[model samples]
Target chain A: MTMNKLQKSERFSVVKKILIIITSLFAGFATGVFGGGGGMIIVPILTGLYGLQQTKAHATAIATIFPLCLVSVIFYLTHGGWEWKSGLVVTAGVVVGGIVGALAMKKIPAKWLQPIFYILMIVGGIKMLAQ
Target chain B: MQYLWYIIAGLIGGVIGGMGMGGGTLLIPILTIFLGVEQVEAQLTNLISFLPMAIVAVIIHAKNKRIDFKAMLWVSVPALVTACVGAYFAPRVKSEWLSKGFGAFLTLLGVAMIIKIIVQKIKSKRRANK
Candidate 1:
């Protein structure tokens, strides 16, 4: 695919940098505590705030969240969450499936799925909140 | 049987995550609510599982040259500092509180996503009409 040519400035403004830092801090903290979901925060920051396109923002969001997950997982391992059996199983599945999803994302009509996703999340959230 | 469920949950979450939405948001709740995994353990699983997926994704994105590396660096640095601190404190927080907080987070995100999608749909329809 040819690039969209939204070529952002190579230079960063102090204001922009500060905003990025502040939001990143929030994303990182939430990821650490919640153990996942940093991408949600980072994607919008990349797209709406930084002017990247949807696909580019998604890719960059992945790159941004990787280190945060790595760091948080280490702390998790240190702090009594170290059950190798199940974690490894999940990891195996995730590794296999993540690659597939990453490849298929370009082909899928993601717009149709968004509504379902949000509804599911809302139902799941209500259940958890009640429980 | 349980292992199958574990893999299924992981697969579903991974696929969604690889699609760019946060897999952990869905995975954590699935594990805790459906699989009867404890809250902290569910969180841990999400964190561990995402790493490998992220590695693969980064490689793919790198190959496509989609990532903005400079942006990645700037965003990651500050996030790294606070993530470390947050991780350090995570296990110390009560599981109940953590679970509740996550529930709130998920609900808020869901609401926001719905609004965003609606706005997008309206805007797209308007564009098409024009």
Candidate 2:
């Protein structure tokens, strides 16, 4: 999905590009295997490795995850996976909430994003491990 | 009626996810922990559900001119290949072990992120003091 040439003319060396690819491999597989966390991996790569700003990085993350998640959904659906009774309900709510949340991002201060995110990661991590 | 909780679960997870924090990260755990779903099933739900939410979010972001399709290609092409491999193998793994492995991954990443935040905060404070 090539969009208009990136607004800026910045480019990365082959080595850096390769690093992006390798890390994406991790992001892609994580989403496929775990069914989530691709965005977490992808966003850091955009912001840290690629040096995109917060909003752009989040946008690009969705762009990247859209395709990655599509691949996983295909495989999961094909392989004896039809648990959508509850899944549909959740998906429906996610769509409505997603719209508002995406809108809300622009209003939020980026300075606070990292601290909040790290806290979320720690909390989610402990919960998963505890279970 | 019974699904009301599920709806609420999705809503909370979606909002955070929309903020670009990885919806499935929270969503899968929510399903597994609070709603009593199996680990694998929760993962599957997260994956399937993500498709629609991402589409919606992407469109909204696109309209806002937020997405970098160039980056999308750079990262996604290679990721697409391995995603197939991972997806192919995921179902074959034992669910409990898989959950535990993912749990460890989250915990490690969490610890690392917190450490990074602390260091950043300290660095800023030191700069302020100077």
**DockQ of candidate 1, scored on C-alphas against the true complex (2 decimals):** 0.75
What is candidate 1's lDDT per residue for A12-68, written digit by digit as tens? 455677788899899889888888778888888888777788888888888888888
Report the Cα lDDT for candidate 1.
Answer: 0.83
Clashes of 2: 0
TM-score of each: 0.90, 0.84
Candidate 2 has a TM-score of: 0.84
Chain B TM-score of every predicted model? 0.92, 0.83
Candidate 1 DockQ category?
medium
**Cα deviation of A53 in candidate 2 (Å)?**
1.8
lDDT of 2 at A36: 79
Which stretch of 10 consecutive residues in model 2 chain A shows the poorest summed lDDT? A1-10
lDDT of 2 by residue, B1-70 (tens): 7599889888877877777666667777777778888877888888877887767667888999998888
Interface RMS for model 2:
2.0
Candidate 1 runs further than 4 Å off = A1-14
Runs in model 2 deviating more than 4 A are A1-12, A103-127, B123-130
